[model samples]
Target: MKNKSLYLYSFNQRKGIFLLLLVMIFTQAIYFFWSSNTTPQKDKENHQWLALQSHVDSLKQVKEEFKPTIYPFNPNFISDVKGYRLGMSVEELDRLFAFRKQNKYVNSAKEFQSVTGVSDSLLAVISPYFKFPDWVNQPQKEYVKFENKISDVKPKTKIDINLATQEDLIKVYGIGPALSERILKQREVLGGFASMEQLAFVWGLNPDVIENVNKSFAVVSTSGIKKIKINDLSIKELSKFPYFNYTIAKEIVTYRSMKGDIQNIEDLTKINGFPVEKLKFIALYLEF
Candidate 1:
């Protein structure tokens, strides 16, 4: 009886151990399945936050890329969208102007290039905006010869009578010292020659001098407009006429605006420092 009782206690201990191991395995498996399904939603939210963070980082990079660049004479910091942007290096401006003569219409880039006077090394920098304008640009034509080629030779070298002083007038073939003095005296009395044919008016200016000079010379045409509209002519062209500069040209326009149309040539006298006799000498070149 003592031996059977000892065997029964040992058997009970073994069974209790086996039952504890089975429960532990079952609990672990349940916990693993619960975590796998539940953790995915939290991971998805974390992934979305990471993507938003990437976009936010890109915003800072863009800001740095477009910082305002400075250039001489250009007060506004506005960047060029099509040609070049502000804040670009010296190389950028160089490329924009490189083909300027071939492509004249890229206004801002052309202006910048003119201002900066870029060199060859910097061309690659601004080449992105060096697009040629369609309106003004023609496809470069090859120099092909056709049978009826017109010569580009000048018609002839003409004496510029409009530019000649009294000394220069004497250089003409038939104008002697006496004739030149007579011409100058007549110019003083009559104010000026109204036409090239008026060379006959000089006391001793022979027909031969008039004929030779006419072949190489032309008088300024007066047949156009009897009155001048100041705003029509460019500043350089305006300055070519007697006693006019940028300030005077602008003043003429302002005066016309304030007073209305200039009806006669005498109206030019209204502007300050306008020499009436000098104007009469130059009137043939101007028109309304």
Candidate 2:
């Protein structure tokens, strides 16, 4: 009876082990089937998302290509929206409106920039599209003298740009009344131009206009310029100059306080944010 009972126990143990192994194999097959089906579905969905993103990017590129184009218009007639579209700041637009309110017209590109205070780079971009009145485009009539006898012709006297009034400046080919006034205003602010090269610093003077100005005028005498003493002036005072902004003025004052008196242009170059390329021009307004 004991041997029969032991034999039955061994057979039951083997049967249980076989059943567990079969169950494990079935579970692993189901897992493999699920993984294989879901992986392809996930990959397809991922591909669709990538394709959608690419389509969106292509649409954006097309939209960029279809951006609105700009056309020529009179700057004098520019409204707030028009000026905004042209990349003008609020202050610049306000200045234009203010000038226009006085029943004045911006006749030339240079005059437009003078009134608006736009940068040269921006002026270059937009000036090509500026339109003027018919009268401005008309040629002036020149009278020729009929001389009976040959005589020595006196050379035309070159006008001094530093001392030239607005009227004198207007006599130049490209300079109008507004541009003349702007030039005079710039000269007044600088006290005087140290050299003819300093004309390049004038806000709205184009290269061609500058050339005309140089031909007609010379920087024969400098106005009595009040030079700022670098060591003595406060940051506020220094910042008042055209070349020095508040940040650069503060930095200069701090550097001076820390290192003592700035000896020369070389010393100023050591200060952070100093306008190194413009030092020669700026030095005309400053004293060491």
Question: Which candidate tops lDDT?
Answer: 2
lDDT of 2 at 103: 68
lDDT of 2 by residue, 1-288 (tens): 977775666777979988999999999999999999999999999999999999999999999899577898889999989889889999999999999888678889999999999999999988998888553665864869887465777667898887788888877777787777888887888888777877777766767779988888987876567788878889999898878899999999899889888988888889899888788878877788
Model 2 regions lying over 4 Å from their true place: 1-72, 75-130, 133-155
Worst 10 residues of 1 by lDDT: 70-79
| TM agreement with the true structure for every prediction | 0.28, 0.51
Scored against the true structure, residue 260 in model 2 reaches a CA lDDT of 86
Model 1, 1-288: lDDT tens digits are 977775665777968888999999999999999899879977999999999999999998898797564334321222445235434455554554454434332335445555555544443455343443331233443668766566775677665554456677666565656766776665454344566765755544556567866876675533332333464765565665434667777767677779875555778788766656566544554554
In model 1, the clashing pairs are 69-87
The whole-model lDDT of each prediction reads: 0.58, 0.84
What's the CA error at residue 273 for candidate 1, in Å? 11
The TM-score that candidate 2 achieves is 0.51
